[model samples]
Target: MTKADFVRRCRWLIACAVLFASANAWADEKSELKEKALKLNSITGKDPIDGKIKELAKDAENTKKMLKVAAEVAKEKPQPFQYNGAFILARAARELKENEIALEFFNISTQLAMKVKSASKLLESFDGKISLLYEQKKFDEAEKACQELLDLEIDPKFEEAKIIVLEQMIQFKAKQGKIEEALKLTDNLMKLDEGGWYFVRLKGWVLHEAGKYKESAETYLDTIKKLSENKRLKEEEKERWIERTRYILSSVYVDMGQIDQAAEQLQMLLKKKPDHPTYNNDLGYIWADRNMNLDESEKLIRKALEEDRKQRKKEGVEKDKDNAAYLDSLGWVLFKKKQYAEAKKYLLDAVKDEDGQHIEILDHLADVHMALGEKKEAIAVWKKALDTEPASKRDLKRLEEVQKKLKAAEGK
Candidate 1:
């Protein structure tokens, strides 16, 4: 061979040797990572919370390594371990806010769990996948996942999970403007539940969400009537059901612009359980929102805050922070009463609380800022309200209103 040909042959051999060495190094690393993952025993056990997975998720480098090994194991391992690896990867991905990866692995976990015929693992995987899909507003995929969950070979012990899935499916359909389909799902749920009153109440909720206020109110009344006649339910349970339905009926009345009817339902509930925080807050907020009974609304709101604090103490919550919703009620009532300064104070605190970090509450705060002539603050708050994730159809509507408000304020 010529000298140049000999040199070319040697270079080709050297290139092949380097590639082979690099492949070996990757194999070694993959083996080490797989071993480390399998050693996270808690992930594959009855308790799936693994300190190692959580610890690994806390660091970017470790998270990358964990995901790499987990993907390989999920793809190549056998049934149970495959599910375990996928589940671990999903959990870690969720922790790191890698939602798309989490959704993918959760789906893989669900498929593997089905192969292993593990009901609990399947449910967990489905839950993770469905919630991620829902949060991402991938409604079509969420609808499909919900149906798949209902089609699972659900264990008797997991019947409640099935019911919960049905409820989510109904809500999904309702939000998509598929009112008839949503009602049909509710009917199916009622059949599965043997015509339980709660299902009837759920039907009422579906109707209410679909803007069928009259039908919704009637269904709620039907639910209450059924509750009263059910000999199987204890008196206290029946009463509780009736009270909740009444509260729900009140909202239906409010939607129909039947303020008097709404107030009557709440009044009935308050007569029986005077200190019920929710009842007080709802009635007070409704009256305040309508700019009627401002004095009485403020009183009821204050009572709600007080009663809510007492209830939290009774429940042994370590922190005794005031309920954010109740605080919003108070702030809104004060705003209606033209006490903008005090209203802003309560609203600022309300917005700081986790539960109060809602578009509606933010709008209320923004309104207060506008009332107090803080135009810049109001615009900022309205922008923030728009930025907050809308959790429901109502929030979406509120966001539209906020957009309008921002446009008007900016124009001014």
Candidate 2:
């Protein structure tokens, strides 16, 4: 063959070989991508064929790079792609704690998701914003965002979100110490869903703090009953509700001077949580004050003190002041047993170390000092007690009587 003809034939063969290799490589890549797309689709529960098509389309940059290399020797083609890439990117940004990036992406996602009519995606974007505001402690901003969501009529479908928003409002009001506003919010919350036991419990706490003890007790009982009726409540939750209700009932009964009822409720509570320090101390102190169950009271009080010490040690907490009620109970019990000197030490310590300037602690201290013949100290403490603002007419009368005795003793 001629030299030019041989060179031309050789060039044609090289070009054909290059084109054949490029086509085979493209086919192999396409098959591998299809397999990957199918696996992702199956796992994600999306349409396999559509997923494959979208994957090919969205990876245009990578595909373009491949196609450019192939185009040097053969024709290149593009694949179709359609997926919420912006939404996915936004979610990734949020997960990484890149709030600025997340905000940008979320805005884009919201716009795109709205066009797609994806309610769930739109809700997610709003929730992300709400959560960010809340995490920043921007309560007013968070509330505004929550209100916006509510205005969108999302609450009817997102009942959990609605409940959360209501709870947040209640918490915000409570934290501000706006008890009346909190109660009003609680009432509105209850009207929205009367069967929600959490709202009932919140209402009870509000009433308790407002000194409506009887109403608080009734609400607590209702909360307990409602929680018990909820099949979705875990066993632990039900037990907690019962324990809380019983504890509140006991406290209210004690406040109302219904000692027998208080004792009954406390007994039930103690049975469930035998070593509960506060309950043990309160029940023991109550019994001692009533001059009933002295032996049991002493035992319970000692146990409570031990538990308190253990808990304080664990939590690295220090109570610089004495527990006035605990000391008063111990002192009164010692006086009942005629251990006058020992009673005087505890009562004096209680009066000296008590916070809140408790009148009852001072009264006990004065009475103990009188019994111990420390007449001057007794008179001083009695006068101090009389100076305190009495909560009731009975307390005022008692104060007056104590003062009269102190004056008579001083005169003598």
Candidate 3:
């Protein structure tokens, strides 16, 4: 699923919990404040809060009373109810975007859980803390929490939490650009998990990040075969993994300077999903980048753009015809074919849509301007790109190229 769909699917479980109307916990339970909250719920009768006004206690007065009672129970009860109350409060705090309070309450809930049972029963709750920290971009804190969690002797029931924490720690490390650290965690996970195509696919990703193109290519090829043979994964799941592995394989083979192998991989994908916009764009960009099959590349890029527009419209969203990356592909292809003015239009559209911060898009725009003899515009764009590029070897090389272009232009 797309990111938006994933969020929608899980939103109710996290933020908008349907308060238990069943004889579960809340129904069999009663405190003075809890009764007050329920009374308000009956009176309100579903004006808002999804027919469950008890989720918010209807108004501030009852909400305040509920908070006080929850706090008291958390201190005085020291058992199952305290754990339950803290979890509810944490969910409330999360909805309010009070990250610190949410984390504090979740940790409190876990601590209270240990008092109820000899072994920890709150790793799932502890997971809420990790997610909150990651959402707030507290990567270091999140990773530290992961390490602390792994250090604990979690119950066999909660052993699955270990895998979750490890994956989260790896994600945090990767987000902070510590790819090698993430690779080590991936290796650990591979050992812990039952052997599957998933780990093999992840190994390919790590190899690609480390710039081991030949190894990445080999692993990705293996990943496809393993994905096909894996009976545990559903057909849709296998399809996604296989397609992604094939795409990566093509890119890796291209980096290995085996263009024929790259072409064959892409051709294989297109045969399965002929109108796949992403594959069309990737193949188009590859041929454009290599300055081969210029006419065919143009056709493929245009088709990709057209398909994207149709798909977006069908999905009930704006068509976004000026998508910067696709425009860049088309513009670059046109420029390679010496169609300078036509290329200039598409490049400017790309820069406009990308808002001038995308390094490669700005570079393409600057080059187009230079080709059009618009020296002043070209120099300005090059300087902007130079300032915006990040501190990486590839980006530093981009900076140097921009600097060289600026210097050469000024000299004339």
Maximum-TM-score candidate: 1
| Model 3 whole-model lDDT (C-alpha atoms) | 0.73
Least well predicted 10-residue stretch by lDDT in candidate 1: 39-48
Q: After best superposition, candidate 2 residue 367: deviation in angstroms?
A: 2.3
**On lDDT, who's better, 1 or 2?**
1
lDDT by residue (167-247, candidate 2, tens digit) is 666655553456788899899878877677878888987776566778887887888788889888799978887887778
- When summed lDDT is taken over every stretch of 10 residues in candidate 3, the lowest stretch is 37-46
State which candidate, 2 or 3, has the greater TM-score: 3
Ranking according to lDDT, highest score first: 1, 3, 2
Question: Can you rank all candidates by TM-score, best first?
Answer: 1, 3, 2
**149-247: candidate 3 lDDT, tens digit per residue:** 778774676665576677777777766778888888787767766557777777777777677778888888888988899899889988988888898
The per-residue C-alpha lDDT of model 2 at residue 96 equals 45
lDDT of 3 at 394: 54
RMSD of each: 7.0, 21.7, 14.7
Better of 1 and 2 by TM-score: 1
Q: After superposition, which runs of candidate 2 have C-alpha atoms over 4 Å from their true positions?
A: 1-185, 206-212, 316-324, 351-357, 383-412
Per-prediction TM-score:
0.74, 0.50, 0.64
Clashes of 1: 0
